[model samples]
Target: MNIVCIAWGSLLWKPGPLKLASGWHPGGPLLPLEFARDSDDSAELALVLCPGVPLVPTYWAYVDAPDLDTARAMLAAREKITPGHPESIGSIPAIDGAPVQQEIAAWLRGRRIDAAIWTALPPKFAGVGGRMPSAEEAVGLLSRLSGETRAAAEFYLRRTPPHIDTRYRRLVEARLGWRPLREAAVTCPA
Candidate 1:
């Protein structure tokens, strides 16, 4: 099967064990992406697909896996999602008729990609009860980060692909003065 992995966040820059047969290509699929998940690992508001939010462009790359299950497992491992929480990783052969999934299915059919997988971690904040954070709230969280945590967040924001701009990204840029690093210095953070 021609499986591919879609990404819009850290996976692009820090793909740990996802075997990519090719580099990321633009025009993957437009989804409602936002920095909504407060990640424990990165200590930043990690990006996630948020329903009803503005759709943003994403990137996709060919996975070296043999089938959808393998691809999903690889992505789950890369994202540190455990097996029990299978919902955290989304696959093209979805269970429900989610509009976003339908849109992605069409995109996959158009590209002749047999299957696709993506990080489907939900939006989470400390006291929000699973609701996504607003741009203002996200910036408030970022503002409170210090030391390496702050630097890592800044690095993550700067390293994201320019075309993956989302509402929260703009707010972070405006409020925290964090912009995408110049192309010449796009290397991973130290």
Candidate 2:
């Protein structure tokens, strides 16, 4: 069984807890690859974060492909759209092929799952540390999600902005309690 992890937002730059927890390395030189868009849209260049000498980390972007040829094709025709800069586009792999939900389910067994669900709140809702779900919250939410929803949510969280940073530490502290907030990496003043 194979599980695919798709990255979208900040995860594209700095992979969060999920990547770290999954034992995937973060930060490295990126390689340019071409990705095909829907239909006849022009191909875009994407920068894929390559780990050590070989072996790409599954946490970076996982997509189920029926075979190696399909995987190579998907990887070949991909593009990455950078945040705050639409013009700064590149190519990256896009997973599309046979249904691998069962494989994902089997693989998830006995494994720790860390996911971040993305939602669009008003600008005022944006705070520091971004909007990471608490450990309990993440577990609860993922427990009730369908495979596709889970996949989409993972992608969204990876691309979400750091709305929970220092600016609104006070509000978050008051809301979620100081201890958990601190432990969650969203520190606030005492």
Candidate 3:
């Protein structure tokens, strides 16, 4: 059976126990992603766009396991990848129109049991929650913080609600005077 595992948060940049057990390296030339945090209250997450599925607001980390046991084992291994703290694993039941969830369900329909599981650190312990700052605020923060921190903040900001355009316009106008919005030629690496 085909299983697709999805994970957000710290696991995106850092290699959890699962990735390590699978003989995969978390940071290297291939993965250009980086994360940084200030205290335990806020953090920034970013990744270089890779081939295959685009890692959007919700990125799906796909893995095909033979059975639920194997999937659980992988998750367990992933939990131990780190030295001190361990990541959490859970099944992502059907909810919302999440493409990753739907894809896993579709795989299960044909196969006997296309079981899948996800792994990540707890929100509180991971310090993942932060209000979506205005574009101006984000820019200011980015300038002050390191590149890794800025990238993480931008990644979260992009996924945030209330619309990027609206927030950016409001903040830009308020901070840098009123000006018409124009599409600039900016090269963003995935």
Candidate 4:
């Protein structure tokens, strides 16, 4: 059975204990990624896909997760989704639709890669009664943050997937009205 973990966020930069192979694609079907969720450990805003403007592009990486159950457990643990929702690993093309996922899937298969555990759970409800925040609301919340909280927010904005969109990045940066977080990782390297 094929088992590969899909990474479109921090996993792109830090794979944690999963030991995923090194390499990635500037993935597509730009999903509506937003910093609508709060980080329980860090107390800051983090990225999570939710229904919104499909502007942010996605990035994908093939990680080594030999066991399907283990892969789900690891991702759920990392994404902080406990008692994982009924649709945790829901379906591929599940959210992005068949065509988009098919394009990406076929591309991977052509290279002899099949992502059996394709992707992380959405961050929408990742938190305890967490609500997905809007771009404007996010910007407003960001504008009020200070210190480490603010830094954590910046790291999140910079690390998300596909590839960074400078326009949107600039918009977020402009909203915060502060210099971007120092060139540092929001998450530790594995």
Candidate 5:
């Protein structure tokens, strides 16, 4: 199966166990995103899909899996998400025409891929009933983080793909000064 994996944040820099058949390609589908999820694993306000927000370009790479189910399982394992929580993993098969998948389905048209998957974790501020935090609230959470927790948070924000300039990212840059990191320049030996 020609399956692809989509990402916009940490996965771009630290893929951990995700098996990719190709390097990331720019110009993936545009999706609404924000740094709204307070990740338990990293204690960072991680970026997640946010429906009502501005759209940003995501990155895509071919997944090194034989089929969609295995692809999904592989991604779940890489993301550390336990079984039965399929909501955290979004999978769109070319044969399935669910209306909710129209945007991605359209993107799939004329492509060689047979399916695609992405992390679909929801917005979950710590004290806000799993709601997406406002820009101020997100920055406040980042500001309160100290020591290594703070460093991890900043690293996450800075390492996000440069094309993903979300509203919350702008706010974080303005308030916390955690701007995105650019690729380091390479030097030749003298």
Candidate 6:
């Protein structure tokens, strides 16, 4: 196949595909690329790539696709990105023709998968020099938030990997403390 869709987050596990893919690869860099960005649908923060930030351990998978347009359109729809923003889809340059999969791996090692999902939240994420709040700053932001916003941040933190950064984890846990909200009792509809 000459084209393939690269996945970094939830798309890694659950890819909403219109057609069955030919194959997939399990690739991980010692430090996965990650950046924090705002979400329109969930109304919370999302981990994406921000330019200039240190990368973290993460996974990216490549799915076989021979047709570029089909792969790009389907991946864009899956990401909920608006049409017309092909750059946001984050495909590598066409380069005349498809490069070998091994070459793709080399390119990914130095670049971040973080793309422009929601343009309103932050800037300088993709290249020209914008970056997300540092881990400490983000933790503080989460601490200040309440309700679903705070809860969502905590939930995502707990779910993601590279959590061994206890200092960062501690800040997030301490600032945006989380607890299960229990109902008065298990009251059933009569």
Give the whole-model CA lDDT for all candidates, comma-separated. 0.80, 0.28, 0.39, 0.53, 0.80, 0.46
Task: Give each model a TM-score.
Answer: 0.90, 0.20, 0.35, 0.67, 0.90, 0.58
Error (Å) of candidate 1 at residue 99 is 8.7
- Model 5 lDDT per residue over 1-190, tens place: 8999888887776777888888788778888888899987787888888888888888888889989888888888888999867667788863233224455667888998889998888899875545988788888989999999899889878877666888888988898898777761111123
Candidate maximizing lDDT = 1
Which pairs clash (backbone N, Cα, C closer than 3 Å) in model 6?
31-56, 32-56, 32-57, 32-58, 35-48, 49-114, 124-130
lDDT of 3 by residue, 113-161 (tens): 3455654332221234423333444446445655666555554534322
lDDT digits (tens) for residues 1-190 of candidate 4: 4545544566666556555554655553455555566666774555555554355655555556665566666666665667636245532324333223343455455554544444434444334444655467667767777888877666666555324443444567676654444452233234
lDDT of 1 by residue, 83-182 (tens): 8888788887763542346557778875777878888877998745478887888899999999999998888878887767888889898888988877
- Candidate 2 residues lying further than 4 Å off, grouped into runs, are 1-3, 6-64, 80-159, 163-190
Cα error, residue 74 of model 1, in Å, equals: 0.8
Give the CA lDDT, 0 to 100, for residue 4 in model 5.
Answer: 91
Show model 1 residue runs off by greater than 4 Å: 95-100, 127-129, 184-190
Candidate 1 colliding pairs: none
lDDT of 2 by residue, 19-38 (tens): 22232222212211111011
- lDDT per residue, candidate 6, 1-190, as tens digits? 3444543444543467524343334344333234355455553445554444444443444344456566667776777767655556544544235332333355455555421111112332223234555667666656677888666666555544432223444555566554212321112123
TM-score, candidate 3, is 0.35
Error of 2 at 77 (Å): 1.0
In model 6, the runs with Cα more than 4 Å from the true position are 17-26, 29-32, 95-131, 163-190
Mark the regions of model 3 whose C-alpha exceeds 4 Å error after superposition.
Answer: 8-64, 76-87, 92-113, 120-122, 125-144, 147-190
Q: Model 4: what TM-score? A: 0.67
Clashing pairs in 3: 17-77, 17-78, 17-81, 18-78, 44-152, 45-152, 48-190, 49-190
The per-candidate count of clashes, in order, stands at 0, 28, 8, 2, 0, 7
Candidate 5, superposed: residue stretches over 4 Å from native: 94-100, 127-129, 184-190
Window of ten residues with lowest summed lDDT in model 5:
181-190
